[model samples]
Target: MELEQDLMVSERKKKPFRWHVLVFLAPAVIVYTMIMILPLAETLRFSFFQRDTITQAISFVGLENYIKLFFDPYWVEPFLNSLWNNCYFFLIHMLVQNPIGILIAALLSMVHLPGKKLYRIAIFMPTLLSFVVVGFVWKLMLSPLWGVSKGLMKSVGVGSWYLPFLGKEETALTTLSLISVWQFIGIPMMLIYAALLSIPDEVIEAAECDGVTGISQFFKIKLVLILPTIGIISILTFVGNFNAFDLIYTTQGPLAGPNFSTDLLGTILYRTFYGQQLQPGDPNMGAAIATVMFFIILTGVAIYLFFIQRKLTRYEM
Candidate 1:
């Protein structure tokens, strides 16, 4: 027994302490906790308290803010409208952007395609442009007077088709959504393109040997293999669209003008937090809205992880 105990102690001592791992990870861990975790916790804490409108005193109000948010028409109306717009924005991307990306990726993946590198760069270049630049450029291009869009339409012999899309409430949100799709479509295209390229040559050869070729083979094999990538892109789109603010704010201002037709949750949060012309800024309400946004993003990611991700089969190459 004594001999066995000694041997066990010797074995335990042989395992060296890995201080290097901790040293490498400490900076990132500390940074993340400070930047992300602490702020998130503070936001949640603020949501449950309220400040007196006149006295400027804060007091615990529990779920009163949430209740007011849901039941008060002043808050509820804009919140619902923004939420719906956000969903519509996400839907447009899912329907239009991703399908187009897949088609482009398919074409780009073709063997011996000419100017393939140039085409990829051209498509992706817009994504690197700042949102301020993109918004300003598009706003100018869509200007009713002396804008290239109008002139281009006339040149194409479809002069009647041109409208001030950004000026009209009905078309503003849709136009912006399409513009966003144009800028970021390259992301999905590149991701899907890489997934396609990663498929082993042996698999292609085997498929050809078995008489599987062309469009039919892509639908059956390549598409199936990249389902996991598609799922990831969908989740990314959800998170990004839900958090979208910059372009809308730049183009339409904090009012999200034309009767708030282009308002989104991010805009709502901004307006509520910062106050507008007549409205006083409500930090507690702003924090509540932010907390709700966090939960919404969390719920979406959780659904993807617990439900969607599990079902996607990542076939080994």
Candidate 2:
């Protein structure tokens, strides 16, 4: 009798099932499944099969396309070049943009900075512009005949240093990377600034009580606490960099310009699937490249999730 009464009491204590909650969530869940999940699944499925060009017959090719991608000279060279360029692109963001963002964020997070709001708006303004607009504007600004960059350089007595940056094979990719960095640095800065803002006032007060001040306080207290935000931004940067195409396509064209110096995996994938000029498009081969890129990005995400994210200490407020 006692056991029965206890069981009844525990059952009563449990909250009643809320079927209406599911009703509220149903639209979003259904839409996400249709929009995101279905497309990705179909893309993955397409990668495994070979498609006939004439009859439009599709057949299972197993790993034949992937094997070709690895060993074929034409595929291998361009694939490797794009891969290297992507690594360099990511490296520039990680090394140059991230540090500068942190610096700017740290400066902005100061309690009483004059025109801080205006500064933030100005810094982040580029990020709000369309990639096409930014690309075209920069292209014109950098053009020698247009003289924006050349005039600026002359003002600094370095007009002779002006070169056709986008036209040069060696400098083209680096210039694009820098342009991308300039546009996106605001993301990391804003994220880091928000992280800094979330720190408890008590923590900073305690640090000040302990004679911690200025840069030392920022380094020891604020920066340490914002590691999780930094990690999140890093992973976001990785994904954005790997999927980068719009700006490159807008600025440099599908050919990736100057003997393919700025070619990236996304641009390659685009060219492969759609064809360019005399070279015919190969959908099956393009799917293989897409599959490779998917795996590469998936691998990076897995490593970050399982390894790096695990190491980050999530502090309780």
Candidate 3:
């Protein structure tokens, strides 16, 4: 009995560490913690502090930066404008990108479609191109002076309809939003395509048995099944749009020009953090803006997790 008890105790105490799991996770955890987490935490911490412009001294000032961001006329006007522009950008992507993606995905999912791989490659190829390249190319293409877009429009009997889209305040943001949509639409297409393909053969066969076919079948069955994926795509679009800086910066410069018509939160943040031509860099204010962005993204993610995800019922495959 004593020997058995001792053996049992020894066995219980002999806990082996899962070294393999730690080994696999260590690299990713270390990298993420070092890069993402540390930077984010530092930004948040910095936001609560203030810097003296004249004396060049830093001091703790809880919420003053945020208060100024919300209230000060110097900051509030551009902030609101950028916020609205960001929303418009996101709305365009949601309306144009996702639907087109779904349509393309549905078409590609068709069994008898020829050269599906070729079509997929063509649609997705632009996504792999650098943003700088895309922006520069699009800028040249849209240039009213000598752009091929103008020639193409004239070829299609619409030469008079061509406008300098990127040069006008009214059209700049919308035009850039459309350009962004064109670049990233393939993401939603591929994701929705995968989701559509993942729908079991059994479910599809059952749907067909009930005289459901063609567009009716797609709307009734496939669309319903891919709601979760669409939701995911929507959230991703929101995050990406809010975080957007590269293409806008590459195309419109730090001012997000056409009279700041194309300004977004990201562009504003960059300008604030790094300083524009006349304005000096303010790290504290930049950190505060970044914190706001973080919360905005967090709120969106939280909504999706707590409300949207709960509502979206995942059908078991």
lDDT for 102 in candidate 1 is 97
Backbone steric clashes in candidate 2, count: 0
Q: Per-residue lDDT tens digits of candidate 3, residues 1-317?
A: 99999999998899688799999999999999999999999999999998887897899999999999999999999999999999999999999999999999999999566789999999998899999999999999999877699999999999998899999999999999999989998999999999999999999999899999999999999999999999999999999999999999999899999999999999999999999899889999999999999999999999999999999999998
Candidate closer to the true structure by TM-score (higher is better), 2 or 3: 3
Q: Runs in model 1 with CA error above 4 Å? A: 1-8, 13-19
TM-score of each: 0.95, 0.92, 0.95
Determine which window of 10 residues in candidate 3 has minimal summed lDDT.
Answer: 110-119
**Which residue pairs does candidate 1 place in steric collision?**
none
Q: Give per-residue lDDT, candidate 3, residue 310.
A: 95
lDDT of 3: 0.95
Candidate 2's TM-score: 0.92
Candidate 3 total steric clashes: 0
lDDT of 1 by residue, 1-317 (tens): 99999999998999898899999999999999999999999999999999987897999999999999999998999999999999999999999999999999999999576799999999999899888988888988998976699889999999898999998999999999998998899999999999999999999899999999999899988999999999999999999999999989988899998789999999999999999989988889999999999999999999999999999987988
Error of 1 at 174 (Å): 0.3
Find the candidate with the highest lDDT and give its number. Answer: 3
